[model samples]
Target: MQNSFEYGSTRVKPQRFGDWVIEEITVSEDEAKFFNMRQAFQGKHSEMITAGKFLRLMQVSTGYTVMSNTPMELKSNEIAFKNARGSVLIAGLGMGMILEAMLTKSEVTHIRIIEADMAIIQYVGNFFKDDPRVEIIHGDIHEYEPASDEQYDYIWIDIWDDIDVRNIEQMAELNERFSNHCINMNLWSMDLLGCEPEDYYKIAM
Candidate 1:
């Protein structure tokens, strides 16, 4: 789908860091107004409403959702990418933002992306189709089993719809089972805030 945010008349070249490229676009005031109006009608409040600037990663297929301009989301990306290394496994591929960031890290060797939705895979696949370091697996995380010979150095999970105790438990369980021998395992819901597993469950209950 075409992005609802209008890219103003500015020739901004995409910036490349390692294997990842990011394009900066000017978000027109008119588009922002329309987006706010649509959100109001839908009774939704989004921090992603473009005001002046927006970033577009070439690796993502879903144009609108792929835009990353929010401060909180950007900070989360920073934390996640900083900890990524070696043969990595990511559970969710939302807009491929985390994937793009991880690709920029020289420490990351091979990345295995497991996405349950075929449409998301098809959309984001266009960006990384030529990259030999990436392997896209179409499967559900809950039922996923790594080959006996396969082992990852990092397992990052971000499939939760939102942060809650149940989601934390499920993600922790996945990590325990799939990445027991991995060097590191992280969850987007937990790692970003530096929240301990015990603390999270305690507060959640």
Candidate 2:
């Protein structure tokens, strides 16, 4: 953990796993170093690395979502879930911070979390074992099939391996399929800084 920097609306911190310092900014096109770093940190599963108030989800593989439970990130999702009630479906479970924030709202009755990684589910599940409102389902959001009778009042999709245009478009497509039309549907957007797609590539390069 290191001092934090302001990245768009969120406070970004550098996460050190061995020799690799995982910064908030997008890495260069050459991902070999990051891949190797992932290998080094792979065996350390569900180890919640903290810097200030943020929680870092370190994984063993590359090309997966890189998330930090920053206050700005948590606040945005919390505000979105303010009026949320009945049933809410969350597509990605990072560190369970968002889920915890949602629980603070009395309107929210049930929360179903879909996570692709069982390790993450196991790790995060420990924090909410006593809560009856939370349900963890191990499955990819793309392959997840809700019960025929189930309907969510809010659908939030935050799965992002990278914040590129293609990934953003994929999230949009998934939201269209799974989101309840009558209520609110939210997808994590990388356009937080109002930068164009080309600008992101420029920064990464």
Candidate 3:
């Protein structure tokens, strides 16, 4: 059964944090499990919209439906995104759930996405192509050269399944570049962020 909201002044403040709000939130843990199951097996738009097992970060309201792809990068303790202005560069587009959130923040003006996997980039661009705020770059973030005079407010690195740690030297180089540019760098570690049986959940909770 669908849930309905009893109208109230403050309650109708348009539940929004960033670019999203509590569209609907399923209360029952069992319902959440069932919803997750449906997403895992089901295809169509649900698969694209769903954020896998990372939906826990959303502060689901008493009666609102929330769809997310994994816990949001900003909400995760291991992964962090800071508020800033001007252009931002993001590595590893993933399903673009984070990118969508980024667009909602008025502080962010332009977005340059770096993705190594063509297929994933293609998928996200195809789905979100209509958004004029995003600029897609299909190449290795390590190889791409930020404009000589370009200074970004933020640089987010989440290459590979999570943060690509195999290339420590490359990571160091990127960090150095970010430091030089006075840009805040964020590295999203899949080892820590990926859906695995780990005790970090306790800390996160």
Each candidate: what lDDT?
0.64, 0.58, 0.51
Per-residue lDDT of candidate 3, residues 23-52 (tens digit): 333336665566667766753223222223
lDDT, model 2, position 97: 63
Positional deviation of residue 76's Cα in model 2 after best superposition, in angstroms: 5.2
Q: Which candidate number has the best lDDT?
A: 1
What pairs collide in candidate 3?
24-64, 24-65, 25-64, 25-65, 51-68, 51-69, 51-70, 54-70, 54-71
- Write the residue-wise lDDT of candidate 1 on 31-131 in tens digits: 77797788678654433365676556444433323335444356545555777788998888756777777776778899999988776576665578788
Steric clash pairs (candidate 2): none
Q: What is the lDDT of candidate 1?
A: 0.64
- Report lDDT (Cα) of residue 118, candidate 2: 71
Deviation from truth (RMSD, Å), model 2: 12.0
Highest TM-score against the true fold, candidate = 1
The reply for model 3, stretches above 4 Å from the true place, is 1-68, 72-81, 162-167, 190-205
